[model samples]
Target: MAPQSNKQWTVNGTSGFDALKFNENAPIPKLGDKDVLVRFHGASLNYRDLIIPKGQYPFPQRDGVVPASDGSGTVEEVGGQVTRFKKGDEVVTLFNQGHLGGSLNPTINETGVGGVIDGTLRQYGKFDEQGLVKKPKNLNFLEASTLSCAGLTAWNGLYGLESRALKQGDWVLTQGTGGVSIFALQFAKSAGATVIATTSSAAKAETLKKLGADHVINYKEDTNWGETARKLTPDQLGVHHVLEVGGPTTMAQSLKAIKIDGVISIIGFLGGVKGDQPTFLDCLTNICTVRGVLVGSRLMFEDMNRAVEANNIKPVVDEKVFSLEEVREAYEYMWAQKHFGKLCIRID
Candidate 1:
């Protein structure tokens, strides 16, 4: 492929809430040592994308910083010393730009791809080759786009802790049918752990079952849904793990549902930020552990792709592909939460 100019969305400073406008003046970024220039095929929207436009998360110093954390594309160019990826390689950019391996560090945590740095919602994106992972062969660009952030969050939340042990025949609980929870369901089932999933809609219960949920709970019908969760686990030991995406409001219920010495992975704040905090008595009674999860590293991304390839699992994507010009509509659709899976944008 020939070298080409870049096209991107620009958020005008005055109207922070306004839609991003196309800007031709944006310069195509130059590839540095160990860098790869990717011509993005598709990108996925996330809650973070909504936060950035409202200035909840400020953009980095780079001009015209596009706002999407996850995407997949074909490598268009690579700089000298780039070994892991090459031109024409299909890859996904890790959300954390340079955090490749080892334990998380403050330095590595400072920068991310889509927030505080230029993101993937563009016709082209550039990053260090270390930040890219080969897209799983089973996934198309749109499906792979959801993996970098959401998929990795689920993986890291379930497996990241050094102490928590998730074994075959164990039971895990996931709240809602959001991206992370859905990924957790698939991963837990693949690992031989039975999954109990929760959904607000009874209609979505069948879909959750189809995704391999061992038991599905309509949280709306059962106000005491935690008890329902306990009944689903083997020997009534309660679930071995809980993907705690519901934050404070549901934390107590999650604690109630987990078995003694169970692990709770805290990944989101969907269920309001303020509530009656859990007491030490509750912790002592349940012997539960809660771990905070940030989106994972590039190394985790590679491992996830390996698992995806090995299992031949395909991500569920309820996509509404929009041209670059219809970016605002795409954002609106995601905000409405009407879609069953990820919403994608076509960069071409």
Candidate 2:
């Protein structure tokens, strides 16, 4: 039976984590002809989830929007016309519902969940049949929750480029141990590519190595860690793919770390907005392609799930699982960068 009311976290008319007001009686919308009613079991956090409530995200966020894009759930009820999913199937949310395949554009960007529309920080959500994909058979809901954003972004960065996709023996450079970087490290290794990861602490470096990073560079000790990473590659030509998440502060080094005609997937700006930033001249000097990545299409998400299942790539989630009421605490923890891998919320 469809639930009479939904329990959820909504963006109250305020800023910051304090704005996440929990409502136990929000109405569950009626399903459209092609819609399915989902009972979410888990949801994961991303950097954007922190900034969106604070009015810091660049996208157009709706008033009172449910505030998480990554969620895993079971189809509890399906509309009569829905064909892709049945009532008992396990599914994961698609970050951009309209993006089925091909390159991203404004239309697809506007379809971003948790921003332009209501999202999954709730017990029940109604989605078009196309908005969710089947979860990997080997992964439970918690592990699958990490995929919609971070996992897919990493997959897109590594394999979205048809002509320059990650290949066997290629060297991949990943920054820090954030969700995307960790996924990149794991995915690259699965594809038989060598991975060089960067982190500030020795403890994290050890963790990175255990995750299959061929070499872990301590950027604090070796300020020129990019050059260090480059030299580790054959003939010192530099890494084939650079996951550039650090933005302004790290771009210069990323330039130094790339080979001629290499690819730098610009993923985020976690390293502060103000800094001595690199310019286009540096890109010319490095002779690399800097592509801005904003998650990926649903097709790519499906492809990534296949890879995750085939390679048994379990996502690294933090040990402390937060309850729905603890969403604010989860946000604060992510803001402090205190947790390793992805932080998730149990939707029960």
Candidate 3:
């Protein structure tokens, strides 16, 4: 039987992670015709999760709303018209609830889970049937939790543009050891592409190599790591895909590393907003495309899951585990950049 009350963590304000408030008895949402009640087994953190609580996100959030978007759970109950899911089925939340396919629009921009609506941090959540996708069978709940945001973003950056889909024997350049970069490495390798990864730490470079990065460059050691990466390619022609996560600061280097007509998928701005940036003329001279990625759609999530299951791709979660009650600590850990891959919060 479903419980009458839901336990959840609510955003207190812009004060910080410590201001997050835990509630023991929030009302269980009344199911609509197409709604399903999910009992979350696990949840994962993202950069947006850290920034939203601190009022750094650009989107407007509902006051004291439940926080977090990446989650995997079981369907405990379903409404009469809920067709996509049923009791006992395991599912993962979609980061953008309204975007099932095609391109993103203004309306879709307002439909993001964690920032624009009540998200998956609660013990129980009522979601529309279309808002959930079947969890990849090969992954555990914790591993599957990481797929909703970072995994999908990586997949979109690589496969969303059909004309430039990653092909076998292609070259891919990944930046740092963040969740998106790590997933890009794994996906590119699975597709038979050679990957060149950049990291400041030698320890992380070694980890990248183990993850099948064909070559690892220590960015700290080589200030012009992008040129170094380009030189590693055949005849210095450069790479086919560059996962551009380090926004303004790294754009100049990415421009140097990309091959003519190659795709540079801009995913994040971890390199700080005010850094030496590339100009329009630089992009014009590079003869490459700079595409911005905003996570991905529900259809993309489904497609990525199938590929993940077929390839037996397991998401790299951090060795440290946090219970639901330790969500604040999880945020702090992510802020410190101590985790190599995805950080998880196990819902007990």
Candidate 4:
């Protein structure tokens, strides 16, 4: 392959709420020691991508920073000291280059892509070799792009160092069919766990069932579906784990649906971040552990890839794919909350 020119979107400012501007004449990054230059082919979108440009929480906007967090590509060049990967290796991005594992640190935020630094939505990116992971053999580039963020979030929440800790025959409550929730459902079922899912419509419920959910609850039809889900369980003691995607509103209900000493992995904020929720006393009374999750480390990404390769688990990608020119439109689509699973942008 020949040397490629870079085309990218950058945040010029934040006042208009439309902060992103594309620059086709952007300079290609030079490779440094221990660096690998990758020609990225695809990028996957997340809910965070929609909120980042509006001067919101999670991470503030930086002028001239690239916007998307997840990317996948083939290694094009390597510096003299690079050894982990050579040319032609298909690889995926890791959101945080530091904070390898075991404990949280400031480095995660400082070095985070699409947050505090330039991200991976560009046509080309030169990353340190240490920050990339080998793509799962069973997945194509578009499927592998999603693992950097949403996939790892589910994996880290379920199997991390301080994971809520699930096992075979355990019961899990998954909130929706978004990227993280869908991945959690697949992983739980793969581990021989019973999965109960909540969705807004009968059609999505049916789809969830086809994906192996044992029971699907329509939260729209039944406002008290949390209690209903608990009653459907074996002992009516509630699910052993709750993958809490809706923040406080669903969390209040998640509290009602949890077993004693159960765990809730709080991974998203779709339902509102602050509002009525389980009281501290309620958590104490039930011995329920609430664990907040960030996307996992390189180590967790590698472990999840091994499982994906061994089990042949395919990520659920939305049918629609946008090109690099439609980056803003892609974010708008994700913001509409209509996509069943992950969405991708083709950079080739």
Candidate 5:
């Protein structure tokens, strides 16, 4: 068999991302007993990708590392033992490829896509069949690309609330208009929950309302946004679920905006690294449950796709398409927080 050729963006030893033009000179990514080879169509960026080069989340064995954990494409080949998918099926990679579900394993945590292992940022990437889910038929490649990491985090954070289920007419609060927060709004609305979405831009607040947010708060205008969130919910009981993406800096306010025993999903660190520690005393007083969420597993990814398919949920994609060569600029745009939604790189 002839070897395949592919273009990949690689960060060599924490320097910078550059085009690494290479022939797939190695074996055609021979599937493990249960793996599949996907030809990537699109990939979306997360804040973690921007922090990699700065050593915030350092990869010890960094050579040939492609930095993106979210992508969707078609399966070109599959292992002999693979049964979930066949050739030419559309699929996306699960964020934590090795960890199937439940409590995180140290070994599984150590080897994650785009971090310890090479990720889906390349034109061709391989993963265990268990880590791949059929893309929702309603979504195109760009929309499907946003789901692996951000979508799962929002789903797990909101729906995974153990204390109380998010019923219709209940209110859910999201901190910003980033990928996860935007997904939170879409999902909350689809689940018949009202969304009180907050953003720094009034323009974005309007956009949020269009996306079915019941109320939008300009956090920049209202410094005490927590009180505003409480006012939006019924009888000052506060929101049922707070999609708490702003860690530490906004944790106290998130606590204030939740109903007694409401769930707060702490998902991101965008509000300055190493802010003041959360006051657990206040959290206890409010009887709020703070759930620390990493991106979810393969099972959650499949379940989320089901929900997306059933609800016909469309991801709010801030399209800034880049070729493989423009990888650095893509990262820069995401870091600048200029994009309203996911920043995608087309790899075909």
Candidate 6:
């Protein structure tokens, strides 16, 4: 018998979480000639998901968009011309479908899932073969799902093409407990680099330490946490890398937090956009390279998977698993910023 309509969650408007809508019988995505279709098993949320719905995303947005970029699933079908994947193969979606390699361009923003294009929050997603990568061998669907955005963004920032890449005993300062920060911490630890993390309270600080942070800074208590982080490094010079997810509001501090020749990977804007900009003299004098990271490429994702499998690294997922029907609740939990790692939604 033909399958009943597929289940999915979608953004119906741009007001807020209230705009997210559920449908019991959304049509299953049809595969294109080079497309691969998958039955989604899990999806993970990033900080971007929280803002994308409010029409405040860094990129353009399309109405009635399916609202997630990170997902893992088994191949349900493949187009006749598809060759890379077969039915039943485990796979994860890429953050930017058109971004197979090289430099990201307008098409990346235009074709991005959950942004200008449809996303993977539904029961099924049809993707170009180039838009998918085999899941990490060591991870389950949920953990592997987190790779597309958070994992790749972290990998992109740390070991990506432009990165000097952390070495053993190098100091890395990750801000907050968001998905990107947590992933960066795990990857840095795996590489034998020292990690200094900043959080709001002692409890979360403990959590960061437990996750292998060498030092923890409570930014709320220490308004000058950046300088403190710099001092914690071996030579008291500054950290080798700063995962600057705080954007303009905290970039001035990130500039203050790096050693000469250090790199600051600008990942997000949790403190809101449009604040004081990083001073040119400070960056130039420090010789700091500031790069904007947007997830990663298919090749980079595949390479990171090799590392994830080799290290047996598992993504730290929030304990509260939201069902497909609880899209709003999951987003609300993320908005509260309490999730330790990634916020995952289970599809049944």
TM-score of the candidate numbered 4? 0.96
Q: Model 3: which residue pairs collide?
A: none
TM-score of each: 0.93, 0.98, 0.98, 0.96, 0.93, 0.96
User: What digit string (tens of lDDT, one per residue) describes model 2 on residues 237-271?
Assistant: 99999999998899999998999999999999998
Using lDDT as the measure, name the better of candidate 1 and candidate 5. Answer: 1
Give a tens-digit lDDT track for model 5, residues 248-292: 888878887889878988898788667576677888898888888
TM-score of 1: 0.93
Cα-lDDT of candidate 2: 0.92
lDDT of 2 at 164: 93
Clashes of each: 0, 0, 0, 0, 0, 0
Q: Every model's Cα RMSD, please?
A: 2.2, 1.0, 1.0, 1.5, 2.3, 1.4
Residues 1-348, model 3: lDDT tens digits: 568778889887888897688888999988999998999999999998888888888766766878998999999999999888889999999988898999999898888887877888888988889999999999999999999999999999999899998999999999999999999999999999999999999889889898899999998899899999999999999999999999999988898999999999999999779957888888799999889999999999999999999999999999998998888888999899999899999996
Candidate 3 regions off by >4 Å? none
Q: Which stretches of candidate 5 lie over 4 Å from their true place?
A: 1-3, 15-28, 58-63
Give residue 124's lDDT in candidate 2 (0 to 100).
Answer: 93
Instruction: Estimate candidate 3's alpha-carbon lDDT, on a 0 to 1 scale.
Output: 0.91
Q: Over the stretch 73-109, how does candidate 4's per-residue lDDT look in tens digits?
A: 9998899999999999999988887756666687566
lDDT of each: 0.81, 0.92, 0.91, 0.85, 0.81, 0.87
Residue pairs in steric clash, candidate 1? none
lDDT digits (tens) for residues 56-103 of candidate 6: 886877888899998999998889999999988999999888888878
